[model samples]
Target: MNSLLKCRYCGWVGGKSDFEWDHMDPKIKTESFLLDFLQGKLELICSGCNRQKSDKTSQDYTFWRWLFPRQANFGPIRAHTFMDTLLQRIHREIR
Candidate 1:
């Protein structure tokens, strides 16, 4: 059997050695993680992104923007509604 790690948000599969073992906030997880994120309670952040994001926001990477873009013309749903869609996508693809 092959061992691989995949990013829950983007589905980027990586080797075990290259992956970080982490989980969503214990109180949130996938089913409730989205709610936490939108309510300013949860952060589905990646380790690599720690250097960039803090309490407010960051522009260096694409994850935050992709998930919660200020401009709403492109994403399939608005930031508020997309939180659910994003979580659904993560569950369907990675969980």
Candidate 2:
């Protein structure tokens, strides 16, 4: 039987076909290109969640929404870590 993976951002769990790889730490402006590139910094996430995450490194949800202006409303059905980050951001915004 094929093993199932759970998304750290969203609580989605299913077969390999149901998920996409998300780079927790984007390789855009890292100091060591080769090291970062070769490292296993990927996490399994739903395709829908991947779209919202894009290349953003920040775990902040509002920032995520802002990053993908066109898909502001689009996001994981239930992102556990993302929601935690969102709650943190909310408090920061309030202050």
**Residue 31, model 2: Cα distance from true site in angstroms:** 13
lDDT of residue 45 for candidate 1: 37
Off by over 4 Å in 1: 26-95
lDDT of 2 by residue, 14-89 (tens): 7777686666757454566455547756666777777776677746644665666675533344467768999999
Error of 1 at 34 (Å): 24
Whole-model lDDT per candidate: 0.44, 0.65
How much is the lDDT of residue 63 in candidate 1?
55
Model 2 reaches what TM-score against the true structure? 0.49
